[model samples]
Target: MTRIVLALAQELAAIVAVGFAQRDEEVHQADPATVAAADLSGVDVLVVRSEPRVLNAALVAACDRAGVRIVPYATDAAGHRLAASFGLALLTTLEAEHIVHHTVPPHREPVCGGVIVVWGPHGAPGRSTLAASLAAECARGNRPTALIDADSHAPALAMMLGLTDDGPGFASACRAAERRTLDAAELSRVAQPLRATDGACSVLTGINRPGRWPELSAERVTACLEIARGWVETIVIDVAASLEEDGEILSDMASPARNAATIAALRSADHIVAVASADAVGIARFIRAYGELRALVGDTPVHVVVNRVRTASLGLDAKGQIRRTLARFTNVEEILFLSHEPDIADGAALHSRTITDIAPKSAFAAGVRRLAADVLGQPDTAATAMPRRARRGRKNKPAIADVAGVPAQLG
Candidate 1:
């Protein structure tokens, strides 16, 4: 009897997870040639990992010759094309993580909850700044929040916030998948608590090492977000810029990390903060990047943040000009302009401190506060308007404040 042979690359084993094994009739580890031979005999399906570092086409075609369906777990665009060409169902992280690992029941079973991803189109567009600030703000409002650093190639959120040696980040999460122990609860164990100096609710900071890229796959990313959503009321993602390069090195839009992180976070986002610089080049890139992001994200709420805007320069006011320009091309209705606060920028870029803490009175700090108000859907309020403190100092039960001007309250 020819049995279905499932050959998984070592790394892909963790990525596709063991749930696939349960879904299949028979699962085994074998070289590509062996799978092809089995397929020729009578194997029904060949589940393989399209990890280029290990598996290749010769192995893929071997299965094809056997008239067996080749199911590959892959993430790149190329993988999708290859799977489509071979009439194989591509196992993406989107469905794989959710189906394979189920620890707690789905929190938002019928209705998905809120996920806020902070993304920047190429360049150093203050994505990190906005992400950190938003997380802090949400937690301060007594809303449970989880901050995820999905920038696989350049994972730096841990270092930026001084979170150290807690548990596995993306890479460690991958290993959990390999052991078949990677679940929502396991992820919570590895998460590092990042609380502001003011003792607000903390955000989870992931691993900071580039050597741990393998841990931050699309599957684990989804898992982390899933668990975070259930535990926290809001999830903030600090995404990297896109990876693709331009000819003659003309200019790069968004960081490679941003694109990868954005795609990975799409299924989870209730809101997205698209960060951009205020300069002409930044604006141009934002216009283009916005279109691409919308195409990928559909009609999700996108709040635009124009960072480092100098009031004196560019003739017209920075905020007004950005809104008018964006309106001309994109359908984004909400735009938040943050004045250029050089003092805070110096501290953040060099010292790694939030503007609210360092230059609490600077324009940049005020902008961040205003942005926070907008995020909560409240009218801009004075800085003295602090988050209500708990009477008995209970960490879980925080006094909630309504953002006065925001049209609606986020659940």
Candidate 2:
């Protein structure tokens, strides 16, 4: 006994009536405007015409939540060919009689691959560096990886990777998604190849200007991420640092804002890497931001990473002290520490390469690799290496240190 709601025009109503009669299924008529607001708890199918904007992201999401399959009807009274334009299944008058008898599978959300969102509080916590490193490490394996520069405020991923910012990157993808035409192929075209990584990684650069943050609507960003999941095995998103929603009181819930992209990414992420610098100010800011981060990514596993760890910042027993502080203040038991190596970092940035590519043996690279391995549940052989002293005679050089027993393997 299939229960269906018919929200079609006058001419198509008769066809749906006959179809339900022939199939012996229960049918209820609803106004096109009221269909979205109507209760569809017990309904299995929702037959709507292509008029009055029946098919849209919100309506589709509502129908999916109500366990209803939306079937758009294309008839003379409902503006012919509208269904085809919207990429919806068109039901003609002739087929309406048997459409109710056809078995349509329940709407199943597409399975997304591993999605890691690197986020942090305000201040440069090396979020972009860690994100790129994680993506590069994932690309080292057989699975394909994509690195998205979602920082609409300061879009430097293109500059960081030494790629041209003129290409149609993340903003373009969001536009395509808003038009409901973003597919796996379209995403592949919008994502540029990271040439330095030998095509192992694909990068979707951020906007060229900070003021263009409004271009990335939350809905569109979510849609783009969905399409990206279909195109790659792993995705690493470099999100904005500030997560505060300042305009919530004055702005519409669906309207795009500066934090919309970051919030959307956090909501859609499988895992979140919350990064914080090892300095005192960074630690304080992260502590204040942790509650908000947990609220945004409820029930999602968050891996805390303390970037740029150094003895000068946190004293001799830096790791032990930081771990104890975090444990005492918060419930975070495990924290990954990435060493502060300015020379290696600057060298990689100068050459437009990832830490893994330019200095694979560096502590920063080793920490990122270990983090990736932990995320993927794989054993990390790089952690077994022994630390070596930096070459003598280099001025303003800090001693190479080991992170979690993984010695720096500087080339």
Candidate 3:
């Protein structure tokens, strides 16, 4: 049975109070003695108005001790600071039925999703394409995922995937987050749905112009991801290349910076995917900036991805040579090589589709599938044996890293 305690507007609270055990009692916590006497036993949720006289820190702490959730009702803009700071924001009671079904349960743990940030050093290293492909592959495995473009500089996901910016983008999410009103159902409504041949996912496009970078503040982005984690299974975010701190030179450290979004995404990520282009210039850039990355995200496991591996740039045995070069400078455990293949990537870009949808059989696509498998923590066999059955008298071979050009159409 669901347990609740309502203390907001009487008639409004009664809307959801119907068909459930109702307790018409007023509990006040003006002082320590009153709070000590107040009982919150047998209550899973405590819905209260944002009033300083009634819902103070002491009462909130008492609810926490009793394992009772505090949810605000009819909370205004001024009250958001006090109400949102402590309230779970998971209960709608009667307004949103879907939220109640997804979040409000008496006997189950709330869903906590993993955040994956795709980051690369300064220079084009195929971050956007890899993020989209990974999201598609995760969705193919029946995990609900959302692809987010948090890249502030040179945001190009909308044009790459042929999505319109008229709908709510990442900026809207940040605004909603700042107000502490962003929820899973609202997120699902705002995000653009992406459907592939075999699976489907959601996409939150980035800002259209570089001038809109201020919209994605660090605090708001963190708040948004926190709300999303309660419902989504996976969130793949594509962030900017530079991870350097923002507003360093500014006397006022509180001033907003354009790089805040990228920094926030990196800081909040459960795991990170660092895409490094396989070339002299690309490798040099990765080597130079990787140290800063380590300092910024301490103790976070970063999976290395060498993109666009071509022997033309670095003569024969490119994979072995690149691996040796990285081993000399950085203490990396494993490297996932994603070779350049233009046909499939170009085809997907032309049709505004994911590489997983167009090039399901190519070595590049297979590599993406393997990366997805690694992220999901399933056996290598889960991706080794292709989900699709092979044609008669033909066996599907494992993915091979061919020294070729990485497609730039979608990258």
Candidate 4:
């Protein structure tokens, strides 16, 4: 009689038993956690149930190096993370769920969807706020939106939305992508649902730590975004600020992982929201970065958001100065101006309430609402009378989509 270890219990156990029974292998039942902990020096096939088991990366790596196949019947986020770490492929469960194993399947078609990337230049430019706000706004409008925090370094979306300690973030998602085990259900399991008090919006927070960047890559980023697009109407990606500044781990150009994640996100974006500080230096950075971003993502629609705008600094309207500078250097016709609202900083600092919720009547909120409308394809019904030629391929092409208070559009 051939001996086989069985870790999953109940219906899963019966199903595994029958499968081995057909193959004439003797089955030995054991706790799934025990299988993960048991020494497999002489074991042929080790099966473990997918549950609150701590299957570290080192153990999975050791199994691979020693030719021991670790079969994880993981239906949850932890199992998927383990399987991907070990380069294992998942097998289908009797209950119609997919778990991680150690093989590759046939090529399948990728899901069709759109990506909304909220990227920022160096410095705190509020990319997280934009990503969260847009996602929540879309959800509020009854459009399903999946918010992905792709900022591998210094992740802030989870904390911003009060989703820390929820579950695995981008790391788990990437691991699943590496193992070819990523699917809608697995993605949903790992993704913490951002409960909408006003409506239905789904948000998947990013990894909270900067040390776990290795687990997520550009390929995984692409796969996760792809999965999100299929599961929702829009994907709001909150990614790290570009590496224009030195000394940032995620922006370290030398790091292939960092480069891959950032480049992949830029390439995959259907529409991009380029965030910049509202100060003179920030505006200058955006002017320079816009050229580089354009080169990275050719012909993709980009919206420039000048965050934290304050006229008191320049003693005159700083927006005019920034606009003049942008118009002179780049053909970018539109720039959205968001004012400095102390309430926003207070909300984030004291309470975790989103700027949209706490300061809905604030100037910053109003600006973001206009920007959101533009993103959602809502016409500016509040705009004053204007010429209507509807000229094709002109800078004015974006005029129909541009918000009134927002700056000029990028041609």
Candidate 5:
């Protein structure tokens, strides 16, 4: 008897389960949410609906890697084409009928890996820097990391890493994902590769123009990230702050999802790194949005990061004060405090390099490394501070306020 996992649309699932039960197959039904994560292990086959609620492309590819064949059900000829587009064998209507009547020894699922979405409330809370730095730091552990700029409102990874935004980028990747052709090789081709002294990462630059946000439709963005799980160990995404589903809910007609990219990233993430710009205004903005973010992620692990931690804003024991404020309002259990380092932020932007690449031993870099360690479940052996020579001109450095809320903007 073959072990089969069924992940289909709810109503369709019941019909299929009854039809496919009498066959010599051990069948188990999985929730759509569970299948979205692609956690298929010790299963021989995975049956799914064509163009499933989740990105079926990722599920199909993941199953292929596990030596499992996907038996996609398509009521019509178009459904078969959609399955074929994802590189799965075409299970024609007739073949699907045969499988329904009898058992077929084909199909499997995958062990999806880390997909971390770094997000924050608007006001330049260091989302881009944290995403880039986290990817770079995770890469230092010798795992292939991909840093994606999914911030439709303000795409900055291309500029921060000094990579060109001219060529095929994340938009191109999304198009391919929508077409169900975004395999590992295609993703590698579209993404610009960034190599640092200690590690390297693949970069998927965001849309060049803000108006081009429509290219990142929820299905496309979700599919792109889903297919991406097969490409690397760590996939770090920088997303916009807005979580409002206003565009989706307020209209009777199907409206364009303005914040779809951000929403999709949050929903697809295995872990979330929520950054806040450690200031009165920044904290207030975060507190207001915390509830909405919580509602969207639904039990996904969230790690709060208080960026630019300093006495200028919150006074003595700034970390403690901020912690109390957040505890009073939100459900943030553990907080990671990053020191205010304007010099490092400026120097990196001046050189168009990542923080670790420019000042690997800086306190800011150390904090990012720690965040990466926590996300990757690794040890935080990052250097505490830069060498004396590397810290030259410290006395002549500008005020932290002058460059506050700058890293996410610059790097």
Candidate 6:
């Protein structure tokens, strides 16, 4: 038998009589004040009146904590409309004039498609470079990918991918989300297609001005991501450096709005790629920022990408030393080292192209490809595979590293 509690006002007493008469159901009626303080143990469902103050976040949280499903009760048209807007199931008895069975919209779950968020600390840690490369690599592997430029302070994905930023991109999508119209069709229309050579990837450019960061709120960003998932196989988001929330903790009106996009991206990400430069200062900054990243993205898998890995920055055996240090000092277990190839990177940037399109055989490109493979959990045969003789001919091929401490060779 289903044990139900009717936490409704006295005006909606007819629901109690009808519910109690139903076979195989045990119903208990209580006043709104009593219901608020009552122990809801062993109750399968709690039916409450659809009042704004009574159906708030705090009440919802309480019901969730007590393991109860809340069903809103409404006898009047105004209350019914308000209940429907709150996404609640309205319950009415047979004695009511008409049974309005309003179908509640289902909660949207994160798509099966992979969501990889590339983030890093301040000081130009190559966050955009790594995010762009990862997205391009995924697309090159035949995965329909969407690269979101979510950097509120400095939006550079458009310039990096050679796409015009004048059009409606991420900001437009956020506005659509705010208006409750964001969906697969809207996402595809706003995301600009890139001129990638090997595979196709759509770019959702960021705000052209830094002042527009307030527009991309955490809720809106999350909505955009949910809509983008329906249209793509992989969603790669390039977030801002700082994860700090600027607001007064005591006042809701003074709450932080900046960095909302970055925080939302990290929170919603299936996997987070934390990129950090491979220099003394960069490493120090990354080490300090690592704790904060972990705190922000609790229990979410974070793969470390140490970019610009060169002997000049860190002497020989840089990978091994950095790996040991990260493992000992931080919670990082998987570390991918990307060597600095200024010529190749500069060429791609100069021509507004991806490294994969310009120099597919470069070590830095190869490292990024490996990182993409790790993120997707699949080997990128199309881009990473090379002819045996061609592979042998390259004398300066960076030593292929491992994933999760296992040694492996990169083709």
lDDT of each: 0.57, 0.74, 0.72, 0.62, 0.75, 0.73
- The segments of candidate 2 whose C-alpha lies over 4 angstroms from its true place after superposition are 3-42, 45-64, 68-113, 196-199, 249-255, 384-411
Summarize candidate 3's per-residue lDDT along 1-411 as a digit string, tens digits. 555556555565556555343334332222322442478786666666554434555577788789876665443442443344344343333443322333433443222236889999877898988888888887885677888999999787778788887678888988987775676677888899888767788888888888989999998887787666644678899999987677776778898887999999998787888989888999999998889899999987788889888778899988888888888998774888877766777788889888877877665666776677677675555344544443221344324332132333236
The alpha-carbon deviation from the true structure for residue 86 of candidate 5, after best TM-score superposition, in angstroms, is: 17
Model 4: lowest-lDDT 10 consecutive positions: 402-411
Backbone clash count for every predicted candidate, in the order shown: 21, 1, 2, 7, 4, 0
Question: For residues 20-128, what per-residue lDDT tens digits would candidate 5 score against the true structure?
Answer: 6456767778875457466676777777666433436556567767766567666654454345445455444423345545344356222123789999998998889
Order of candidates by lDDT, top first?
5, 2, 6, 3, 4, 1
lDDT of 5 at 379: 58
Error (Å) of candidate 3 at residue 277 is 0.3
Q: Regarding lDDT, does 1 or 2 come out ahead?
A: 2
- State the lDDT of candidate 2 residue by residue for 1-411, as single tens digits: 878777877676766577556566787788776678778899888877654245544667788899887787665522333343234555654365545654433453232336899998888888888888788888885567899999978877899888878889999999998786776678788888874343478899999989889988787898788666646768999999878775666556655577889999998887899988888898888888998999878998888988777778889988777777777877787887776667777787888888887877666677877788777667766535533343222334332223644322111
Model 6 score (lDDT): 0.73
Alpha-carbon lDDT of model 4 = 0.62
Each candidate structure's TM-score, on Cα atoms with residue i matched to residue i, is 0.58, 0.73, 0.71, 0.63, 0.71, 0.69
Better of 3 and 5 by lDDT: 5
Backbone clash tally (model 4): 7
lDDT of 4 at 2: 34
In candidate 4, what are the lDDT values of residues 14-85, reduced to their tens digit?
A: 776765544545566666544545665555455664332324343455556656665666565545533443
Task: Pick the winner on lDDT between candidates 1 and 3.
Answer: 3
Q: Which ten residues in a row have the lowest lDDT in candidate 3?
A: 401-410
Error of 3 at 323 (Å): 0.8
Predicted candidate 6, C-alpha RMSD: 9.5
lDDT of 6 by residue, 207-227 (tens): 999988888998788767755
